[model samples]
Target: MTGPVRHLHLTELRARVLSEDPAALEAWEALTNHLANVKRAREKGPRGFEKYYEACRQGLHRLSLLAGIKGISLYTSRHQFAADSKRAGHSHPQTAAEMGHASDRTAVTHYGRRVQGRPGTPLPLPSPEEVKTVRKKLGPSNGPHREQK
Candidate 1:
């Protein structure tokens, strides 16, 4: 784990940087070190990370345009992480904890729905007899409004 990092709203948020290549971690360390030592590059306002956040947003926007990928943003990573976690068989609570949510409801309601192909048993389809029975009980439909005999 690395040192404490600040979020956009100047709140403390713990984040784990995962990378397959050692060079990526090395670069991240170097960037953090550089930022720590240097004077504020932008205006006096905004926490250091916030300034960088804007820069990243602009840079990513330009890069996405060039690559012809629409709607790419920083939050995309978060969504992807949630989806990946779910597909990897993580429980809702586990994913919620990792994502810094207070309860599993947020993770299950929002993040959990992001998994493209959800795991677990498929819902059982009603048999033809059951379908007929239900249809008979409901009677014939007259659009949205039911007719009174």
Candidate 2:
């Protein structure tokens, strides 16, 4: 397997969806095509990228939409927030708090509750019954094949 794909930039993203310029390089075209397969068009769905559950190639590209909306790449925002918080002297305690919460398996639960009120995060986590139903549908053979053979 290869490394985690580095996210793309706004200019790279724009050059992709709006591939009208003929002077664009071959590398750009290749990268854009790869993105097209991984990242669904914004016109398609709101997730920015659809997560495929199979091979590594079948992955999501959430940064595209996030960068577009935030007017800055996710990494930049992450760094910016860290820098700001550090300057404000709130970074250490905040990081520790987040780390403490990280161990809680109720991870997305709190997150979902927050945005459940908004149009965002419409689908809350599946209930136990819902999970059972999905398991029955897939059957044991169709389970995630992550075991070392």
Candidate 3:
């Protein structure tokens, strides 16, 4: 990621997203190209970035609903990424750098936990029917709620 990030002024971070899946890289490249064109056009201005981000957020929400997850926002991915980095044995400073923090305090304080055994792996979503059955067992409310108290 290059350019001025929200944190730490106009400093460029050294972190790069890597994946063994070629399709993931291809998709990222395509998005990068599109974003470049949008920047060049300078038509949308500040709203252009927001428009694309909202589209991505909505896409993720739809995908989560399809997978039987009630809510999964873009911020949730940031938390997951931080935890995954820690689980993968990254140091506090490394995690902070990847997260674009000037210090490790924010990364260590907020995201990730001390875990044992091997690193965590992604799990496939439960079947839709299974989700339906679980929801049924939880009653019409679906599950617990803070407002219930």
Model 3 Cα shift for residue 146 (angstroms)? 31
Q: Write the per-residue lDDT of candidate 2 for residues 1-149, one digit (tens) a residue.
A: 12222222235434444665444455456656766766554435654343332332222235555456434343343344333323333223232132232212222222212112222111112223323322122123221111112
Residue 43 Cα positional deviation in candidate 3, in Å, after optimal superposition: 7.5
* Tens digits of lDDT, candidate 3, 66-145: 99998689878667766665666555554555565555556656764535213543312223333222212112322111
TM-score of 3: 0.51
Which candidate, 1 or 2, would have the higher lDDT against the true structure?
1
| Clash count for each candidate, listed in order shown | 0, 0, 0
Stretches off by above 4 angstroms in model 1 are 1-46, 112-114, 117-149
lDDT of 2: 0.32
lDDT of each: 0.48, 0.32, 0.50
Identify the leading candidate in terms of lDDT.
Answer: 3
- Report the Cα lDDT for candidate 3: 0.50
Best by TM-score: 3
Ranking by TM-score: 3, 1, 2
RMSD of each: 17.0, 18.2, 15.8
Stretch of 10 with least lDDT, candidate 2: 115-124
